[model samples]
Each structure stands twice: as structure tokens, then as C-alpha cells.
Target: MTANKIELRSVNVTRYITPLREGGSLPALAEADDDFKYVLKFKGAGHGVKALIAELLGGEIARTLGLKVPELVFARLDEAFGRSEGDEEIQDLLKGSQGLNLALHFLSGALTFDPVVTQVDPTLASKIVWLDAYTTNIDRTVKNTNMLIWHKELWLIDHGATFYFHHAWDNWEKAAMSPFPYVKDHVLLPQAALVEEINDEMIALLPDEKLREITNLIPAEWLSWEGTNTNADAIREVYFQFLVQRRNNANNFVKQIQHARETLV
Candidate 1:
């Protein structure tokens, strides 16, 4: 997690026009800038604070885990667009604040698989499964691969579903325990050589100071303050715990892959 000096840039809302995706609430577009293209979402969709927090924080976590995801930034609009601009209909649909958007790097590659019919590379799938396990990510399934292929490389996106159970932490005592069933069939489970290679690379890249700093990048407005000043610290702690768990589990999974490969050979 080497903290790359991320310069927060204010986006010019009017310069680029985004087309709305079918069944997608936010307006999205492929950008002209090669360094960052794809403004996939804008703020008018009325999802609550918790959902926003999950997206922002989960993006950071994915970066820390050495997963290839699009660069994310907080964006603002000068004014709300009128009914003709798509705001009128969304206004009726959402309850919270409006007039802002979150920009994510637009993935240029093709979707590798439909959640139900496609298969992922074994090593990549294992890493994703390990990450989901640590973060309690509920959304990465056969239905929403959130996985992509570009230039023969795999990329992950749409982490809005991780830590969905976080708010229910107190109910852990009665929590129904079940293992992630899909782990057994994940494509990455069979790629022992690749998993070992990735494990070493990811571990080497994740630096402690960088991880701490990345946590601070999460927007405070996305959190539940409720007059409590500890919100920031608490959120950071949760992120840290997830990182630790992810590292540990990833290490074990890598070993499992290696052992299995050896046995097969």
C-alpha cells in the first residue's frame, strides 16, 4: 500500500457529458483522458450514507489488496440539472442529498464472464474469494462477477456490497455461520503457481504506513457521525482489521494452492 500522492482534482461537470446506462441509476461515460477514463456514476441517485461509505471504503481496500480496480474520486456538480437533464425523475426516487457524483475509472475491457455462465482464472478467483471472505463482501457471486478482462489481465470493480453485515455486528452472537460455498469452485482455486506468485507480490507491495494513509482518504460525509466524533477512527479500525484478516487468509490460501500443486505433481 505505497501511498501514491493522490491529488484530489475538482471535476468540471459541464465539460463531459455522460450517458445513462440501462438499469443503472448514475450517468456514466468513457473519458478522454487515458490516465483515467470512465465517469461511471454521478451523485443524483438517492442511496443512503451507508451505501456510499461502502463504495468509497471498499474501493480503497481493493487497491490495498493489490487488485486492479479503476481509480475512484469524489466529484461535485455546480448545480442540480433540471428534469430534462435526468434529475427530476431521480429526485422523486431518492431521499438524501443530491448534486454530486462519484467518479470511477472506466474499465475498457470486456466482461470475462456473466456471473452465472463464465469462469474466472483460478488464481484470480482465489484471491478475490480471499478478499471477499476478509471483508465480508456479499456481492461477488456467479451473478455479479465484477471481474473483467483487459489486454489479458483481470480487473475487479463494483465493491458496493462488501461489509454489508458490518452494521449488524452486534448480532454476531446469533449470526448463522456458513462458509462461502463458491470458494470450492472458484477459478483461482486451481492456479497454485499463479497464486503463490501474486501472494508474494501483493505482500511486498502493501506497506503499513501507506495502508494507514489510504484509510484517511475515505470521505467523512459517507460515514455515520450521529454527533459521535469517533466515527472516523472507528471506520479506520474496521478497515485495518479487514486488511489484517485478508493478508492472513490470502497467505494460507496461497499455501494451500502450493501444497495441492505439489501433491498433483
Candidate 2:
């Protein structure tokens, strides 16, 4: 619960349950050695390790801001783990992802968030909107809120779609200061009446040190690729710099959120 230090627990995958076909990454409901079920995200998915990096950074940033996010863990898949799988596709996926992957503690009996039935207060709505905009998360739209209701509380999930700029990795500086036009489509935009009021408070939560802390969570294996010239340390620094610049220019996205909310309401 310390603000400065954040760590993700590691768990070895003990059994592969059925895949959650809804996720593009072919995430599965797998049991870990800890005897807990997790929604395992594979490193061999279409988005590759970048998606895992985004998920880790974004989810941890949300946690740093005092938001409710599922506990993320490093789900290890051994080389021989999935060789016996009957499904060819799954077997190939497991073969390719024979290393550290990301998983979230599975919340049983959790319901997908529906804006129609559930009402969020203006401040909470503002915080979530701020988080999505700051992270450049395009997944929290009306169609896929990416939120879960458990124990009568809202929990954020599926942050793999955030930090999309990293897919290209060249225009990150421009992206840092860019206005998130997608904020208009956020499911909670209409309820985010207090964006301006809570803007400074939320901004203060993410300092340069905090950004570095979150980006440092990305594993070295996740950063290396065949063609990329950048090393893992350099890549981590880029992520940190992007977040620091974005945090420094919070006004840009904050204004975008206010404008979008004005149009929505």
C-alpha cells in the first residue's frame, strides 16, 4: 500500500482453464500455483508484449491514483507446460508465450459495468475519466466499459488498450501532450462533472518518481523484440518520459475532458 513502491506478485501457471474468447489477446481463466484462478494474458497474442506492458503500466498507475484495480501478477508459463494441449491453436500460443505473462486475479461473480443501471458520482466519474484520458486508453468506451462491479464496488480492468502510442514508439512526445479526442466517447463522461475540481488532486498523485516506478515494473523480456534497436532500459526510460511529459501537461487532456463533457451533457 506504499505510494512509492509497487510490486506485482509472480505465480506459475498450474493449469490452463478455458479461454475467455471475448478478449482479443486470447486471455484464459487459468489456475496458478497459488491456488487462485487468474485471467491469463498470453505474450504471443496479436498485440504481443506491448499489450502486456500497457496493461501493467496502466493498471499500476490506476492503483497509484487510489483507484480500484484487480491485483496484477506475473503468470509464468514453462516451455513444456502447454505441449500436451489438444487444441493446436492454444498449444502454439502457449509455445510462443513460454515466459512471463500478465494476469489479473479473477474476480468471481463480478458483473460487467452497465451505465444505465448504475450511477457514479461526479467525482468518481471525473477520476475515471481523468485516468482514461491520461493513459490514452481507448477501450473504456460505451461499448466496452472495461469495468466490473464486485461486492457493490467499481473495479477497473483490461487496460491493455492504453498507451497505444507505444505501438509505433516514435511519436510518444507528441502523444504525451496530445488531447485525447476519445474522451468524448468515455462511458462515464456525462457524469464527470467534477473533472476540473479534482484535476489538480489527481495530477499530484503521478510525479516523475511515480511514473518511473510504474514503468520499471515492465519486465526485461517484455521489452526485447527482434527488430527493435532500443534496449530494455532505454525502452523503460521512454515510457517514463512519456508519462512524465503527459503528467506535466495534464491541462491539455483535462481541457479535452471538460469540452467533451460539456458537449455530452
Candidate 3:
């Protein structure tokens, strides 16, 4: 769906419940509407404006790139919805405390990996690494494991890690090359079975029109666009390059998987 087509709404602060995780930066919860339920992650004062922009724009980019990310929207909370007094201890555990937190609600699903074990298919894992590489996302580590599996498919989440280059655009080239190992070793080496299919799916899913539409949903203030009137071209270029690299990697992986399967047979 296009950004213009998306109906952004403010979430009622009173509706939010206490978070499920502890000592992390944001406050997260499971929330429900009349028909739909989603995980709501609040952007606490610990994170500055950049992180907020990353979450907003990053999810849209992932969708455009054909990755299965949960539907996200910019939601404002009511004035009465500020942090509870009991949250003080949790707040103290966070690193940087800044502006009032905003809430991010994700569609509910099952977690893919446990801290002790990596249970995802290799190709799918690689594709995720590829997607993160394309976006310059730095947080999809083994520790974060922001992937979900449900109904026999994978979905990605927690993308407050992209736009790390926003502070220094020149770092783009370096960031682009860095994620290849993760994509190759962890994602492509093991489960050669689905590399070809996953690659094809990713390539087929990049929607240019959808990307352009969603770009509007990104708040202008957080991007370089605001005072300078510059568009998001720089970041878009990074995303584009990432796609190109992933396609190549996918093809190589497919060939390797085919060779291995043939040998095994």
C-alpha cells in the first residue's frame, strides 16, 4: 500500500500495557484492536530523533525491497500516556534518555531463534542478512534475532539499526561491503536448498512505486530533506546498491546449492 493510502492513527496511551522485556531501551507490549492484534514498542526518551526516523523509514524500505516486515505506521500517544512511575527503574537501565517515547506496534508472531540455538533455514537467514545489508542495518545480530516464523514463513522486525550512516554519508561504501560475510557464511553456506527461490522472491518483490509512496510516510524533519530540501536519494542509492549485491549473491548461492545437491544425489 502507498503511504498516502495508509491511514495513520494515534494510539490511545491508556490502552498500552507494561512491556514484556526488561532493561532494554524501549517499552513494548501486545495490543489489540477490534479485529487485529500487534506488538507495540514504545520509543522511549533514551532514543533520539534519528532512531525514530530509522524505525519509520526502515520498515517501509524493507517492504519495498520485498521483505516480509510487519505493517507499521506513525502513531502518536495521548498526553496522559507518559511513562508510569513504576517505570523509573527500567528507565534508569537505558543508555541515553531523550525525548518522550513513541509507540511501535508490530503484528504478533512467533520468535524464530532462541539465544542458544539458530533454528531458521539457511537461505531464509541469508536473505534476511541480504536485506539488512541492503539497508545498512546493524542490529540483526544473533543477539537481536529479530526474525519471526509463523504459518511456515519468515517475517522481519526491529529495524532501528539502519541509517547508521545518516551521521556520516561517506561511510556508505564501507557499510555496503561489510555485511557480505554474514550473508555468505551464516545465510548461504548451510541451507542451499532455498537460495534460488528466496532470491527470486526478493527480486520480484521490490516495488518502485510502493517505495516512492512509502517515502512520504517518513517524517521530513529526521531526514536530510527538511532544511536543505534534499531528497532521500543518498539513502535510496544505498538501498539500491544493496539490492544489486544481494541479487548477485543469490545467484551465486543458487549455483553453489545446485552443485552441492547434484553431488549429493
Q: Can you write out model 2's per-residue Cα lDDT over 1-265, one digit (the tens) per residue?
A: 3365897899999999898987568889999999999999999998999999999998999998889999999999988898789999889899999989999999999999999999999989999999999999999988999999999999999999999998888878999999999999999999999998998999889877788888889999998976888899999999999888888888999999988877863
Greater lDDT among 1 and 3 belongs to 1
Q: Alpha-carbon error at 131 in model 1, in Å?
A: 2.6
Ranking by lDDT: 2, 1, 3
Cα error of candidate 2 at position 29, Å: 0.2
lDDT of 3 by residue, 111-143 (tens): 664535555666655565556555556666555
Query: What is the TM-score of candidate 2?
Result: 0.97
lDDT of 3: 0.53
Candidate numbers, best TM-score first, in rank order: 2, 1, 3
- How well does candidate 1 score on lDDT at residue 176? 20
The number of the candidate with the highest TM-score is: 2
Candidate 2, residue 169: the lDDT equals 84
The 0-to-1 C-alpha lDDT of every candidate, in the order given, reads 0.55, 0.92, 0.53
Better of 1 and 2 by TM-score: 2
Q: Best-fitting candidate, measured by lDDT?
A: 2
